[model samples]
Target: MTQLPGSYESYWMESVAGADHRALAAGLEVDVAVVGGGIAGICTAWELTRAGHSVAVLEADRIAAGVTGYTTAKLSSQHGLIYAQLLKSLGAEGARLYARSQQQAVEYVAEVSVQLGIDCELERVPAYAYAESSDQVEQIQAEAEAAREAGLPASFVTETGLPYPIAGAVRIEDQAQFHPRKYLLALASDMVGRGGHIYERTRVVSLDEGKPCRLTTEGGATVTARDVVVATHYPVFDRAMLFSRLEPSRELVIAASIPGEHDPQGMYITQEQNTRSVRTAPYGTGQRLLIVTGEKFKPGIGDVSRRYEELAAWTRDRFPGASITHRWAAQDNTTTDRLPYVGRFHPGAKHVYVATGFGAWGMSNGVMSGRLITAHITGQELPWSKLYDPTRLHPLREAPSLLKLQASVAKHFVGDRLPASHADSIEDIAPGTGAVVRVEGRRCAVYRDEDGDVQAVSARCTHLGCIVHFNDAERAWECPCHGSRFATDGTVVQGPANRPLEPRRLPTGTEDSDR
Candidate 1:
């Protein structure tokens, strides 16, 4: 999920793939062609199947391999600091509808878990949006007021079992959590068995969101469907200018499984800047304590190494007995306002639906999206569609971020063409350090560390042949376009690109081999 190793990394993959019965080739058309197999896609498929519509899901990877598996899996009505902010920006009516939709989604998850006999360890619990200081306590009051106006049982909580001090918390009862992968896996099985098609490793190159949406695949297959759902994490086919309207944020999660455990039975959330949330789930007969969640950082913006260390220290101080088992990071789409984008991709296109920009609480909300969109596509009146309409324009607080991203993408694509050699020379670089070098004919990027060694890698990124920039924080070469990252050792860390940075040896021999 985080594109790195963790405790459940190997076990999680084997377990789900063994049970999933799906094919990879593109076949006949269906009522809906869902582009992603994450929780949103599966849930949508489930809803479509129940509605007696045939749906086909084309996934770039296995189900739950995207942001869905990477999520913190909290099905809470309390999206931290959301309702309060929404009330201020979008008014009481907007806030109330948003809260109702989210809470209803939470209830539906528990309802469906029992209905389908899905043993996802679903459990109801209390959730807190508390402040650590008295000044911040007013935040809880404001939030509670908004929640009440929204017809919810919310209040200020002065007391909590956490060792840390807090002024107050806004408590929302009956929020839930579960193993996300388990639930999605079960849904995938049901989708497959009930005539819904899922294809793994089948990346959608583009989607024409026009009438009778035509989806083109990277492998030269076309699926023409009456309707299409673009649930793929970022929706590469941003025909709706979603990137500007919706921002991408990466979150870090580090979990330690306690040897002996007693679950607190409720999800706890703090109102700090970079929020931290905790919950207890079953690892086996013995319960596992998971201290998850942190806040948003644009891709490759913050220091990556610091992410792990901060969480490690946080766990060490909080639960001394718990031994670390899994540590990972996830990225999710966020909107400027608190609501998610769920409906038609854009007004220009017909019969294409999408559910994206879920903030970080997609387990319940995403499932609700699947249900609502499927209903609308099949010509049914879903109760919440008007409120969560994808094209609804809220206040443009996110306009700055969106504008900056578009400008950057534009600048990088043009700027990357100039050879890196135009800037630096080998003489300008210290030994054991790397620099872009200009020779008689070509340009190359060279790296050397304190070890008095030299390594050369192609300055051009594999994705679009644009020159790459070395990220000192991650010790990897980062592509300015699309956020592809490669380690200093030339291994691919993240993708859109499946290949590593090209190795450039010295004219005589391989420069890195000397090491």
Candidate 2:
């Protein structure tokens, strides 16, 4: 057996011992019900609780253990080369609003940490968007100018504190990085301390929006709230078909221990080589965790194991002598308009709201979404929320991306169902791995453990009826259409899909074989 490098868990998750909150036991009523215990949901709940509203947080899993825990945790507005694109699409004022919102989000973490006395390892540092190849220098320069115009403290420079030479870079000052799980776990504690209720393993199965939004849990418990915020990373409900406008991509992260002297000294990213983001966190005495992330791809569409290898190779080349200590992946949704949806769920929604599509900048965007949603619920909406209104559509800017996204989704929805796309026999599935196979004229997601036990589940995604593909590296079946992920036993791991993939019986004729 080939051994994988490092611990197969997030460093952020490993570094902290999070609090354990019980699952929802019975029906309850609160001023607000927040679905999801991630940074966004937790932040929103904390804000609402501080605003004198009774709030209950319902989490399908542990708090801060999802995308927020797996994040790179760079709290900066310096999304690689985003200002240039935003300038063209949303104009100068709109871009400034985004910059200001994100910048404020960075400080919000710092301010809140002090206010709550949470030791979250928050450190202010510069952030950079660099160009490696000569051909991309002009783009970096343009981004610098655009970012400056957008009211950020951005400037173009040739030298970044990187190990390698770069053609040019756009540097933004006053950015920060921290242990997101530490910060969010503290926020979760504060929420509970402030009389806000939190429930774990309480997956919201359905939402009925009205004067008092009614949310039903998988455990048969119910939560009634005057308002509800669906900050479940991806909104569980698609009443407005927001799923159609969102594109899901998964990126790999590898962290290694390096000498403190080798620290990058800043958060850095580039558009080259799929994408490369670099930062460091305090690891141990006189050592720092050199975290590198990149190799973005749509979930369930690529060889994820190979992508991890590529990321490792790239990291080793850039930072020699570094010993890899951890490896994990994060899934993010990008909106058609390249901004998050963080406001009223839809135009018609009176008491329901959603916050999603933070792209890869979840730490900053998640905080911003929380604050924005809090403002909306309290009836003091920020002007910047207009940029993220779920109902606001830019037909001219969004049509092309939206159409392309749906086209790919449509292909997977229809094409993966063909018999030719599935394994001909169970023998095609290797031990300790899985594959989609057609058995007894029915499509099934089958996994064969190293112990030789086989299990099968319906291959159709519970979210939109698209076929689910096995992610060998992560050991989860993932929906390519909308990023719904399921465990080997067919239980939901991530969502847009609240229901588990139904278990299926293997036919008598088809059996596992050694071929």
Candidate 3:
């Protein structure tokens, strides 16, 4: 497998200059406190500000640094073979509402981008879910029919502008794509201009629910608000055992400069067991960047590096002369029934809300969440509210999947603790890589930095005590149970984990004295 020159950075982040927002310094009060700076949070703040409410957005890091910054940015309602399944599980009416919500979200984003004069490279494009095999072709046809029934502009066709031929495909017209970060930064600026506050590097550690809720930040700052929106990619608080109900998954993305002037007219995704997504964006003068993404798996469950290798190999075979320019990965939560949770956090809970479980199609769902959540908070009714209500439960539909997800979590939680480490000392760790090692009879995560300095931290995740495994592709420690990721130095990257991994003191005289 061929390796790239630098560490992973998303093409979107590399191209756009990010917005600057200060962290919360002292206590403050607002009408609504949005606890994440990703798409959902920014959109929620924008909507609330327009509705004449004082809003504050608190981000653990800079804006758009979460899933939004790492997305494929396909703004479409064609989410694999989902419409057909939704018809069976949620019935015709429910499925129609789902399609309507997504379509509205697509229009909302395009309208806002134009209204703000944001140069996000927004374009109207068709999205295709194609099949390369006979069985999947039948599924694609069914999905097209179902999508049309649910009021989507979908049609079944055997021909697409793909590099290779597909057996069949469900093509949705008038869908779109854009530079997500650029659009989001514009919204952040608009919100701030309208008296909405945004604070970066300000992590909301905990929430106290009340008529006027209290949110405590990591730096001993408190934000009192009439309502709160937990838009963090994964809900930090498990008020309803959300950790068990949602299954976390990860996928890899790679951007390469095509050798020639070859470009696909539309975005395409395969419906095979191992899914692959393809799209392109303007790179420079008459040049385009081709993004190919796939290799989905549970975080920490497999060899992360092998997936990157497979992606590179696949790209080499298909786009023969393409060379990798950028590589990155994203993680998302999948609900038992596959619909996003987008309303109040739980039944009978009025002030606190959560928007999560976007699966892999977060671009549309994230925007839909903002609209739905803001409507609920301001005492307005949206047609799709009941459909996406976080408190709604379908015991019959959810029981089996819920049980399977929890079983997997239980297996990992107990099984990881009983395993013996292969390395007895820190010296076994390779430079620029990390692994679990036994130190003084304790399981410790050890990494040797590029400078040959050894760092060690507790192997257990701070979120739920699940053992974390090293992900070599991104060089981060990942929790298998709930998808919390940490840097080699133990800083939290993505979470349900609000705290960093516990640092360990090396035994006396054991450290390399090169320092």
Go through the candidates in order and give the clash count of each: 6, 0, 0
Q: Please, what is the whole-model Cα lDDT of each candidate in the order they appear?
A: 0.71, 0.91, 0.88
Q: Evaluated with TM-score, which candidate comes out highest? A: 2
* Candidate 1 lDDT by residue in tens digits, 1-515: 13333463322332345254344555457888888888888899888987788888887767787677667788888888778777887678878778888888889888888888999878788888888778887778888888878777888778876656678888888788887888888888887788878887777776666567788876778898889888876565656876556555667777767653345556877747577787767676565656566754656453555666666667667766666667666767676555788888887767888888787788777888887888778788865687778787744665666667677666766865665453455545554345557644566667666675666677776655656665443455666555555666676554444456778766654344444
After superposition, the stretches of candidate 1 with alpha carbons farther than 4 Å from their true spots are 1-23, 209-211, 259-262, 271-273, 395-513
List candidate 2 segments past 4 Å from native: 509-515
Please state the error at residue 474 of candidate 1 in Å: 7.9
lDDT of 3 by residue, 13-72 (tens): 888888677889999999999999898898989999989999999999998989899999
Clashing pairs in 1: 432-448, 432-449, 433-448, 434-446, 434-447, 434-448
Give the Å shift of residue 132 in candidate 2: 0.5
| Cα RMSD, each candidate | 4.8, 1.2, 1.6
Ranking by lDDT: 2, 3, 1
The candidate maximizing lDDT is 2
Question: Candidates' TM-scores?
Answer: 0.83, 0.98, 0.97
* Ten contiguous residues with the weakest lDDT in model 1: 9-18
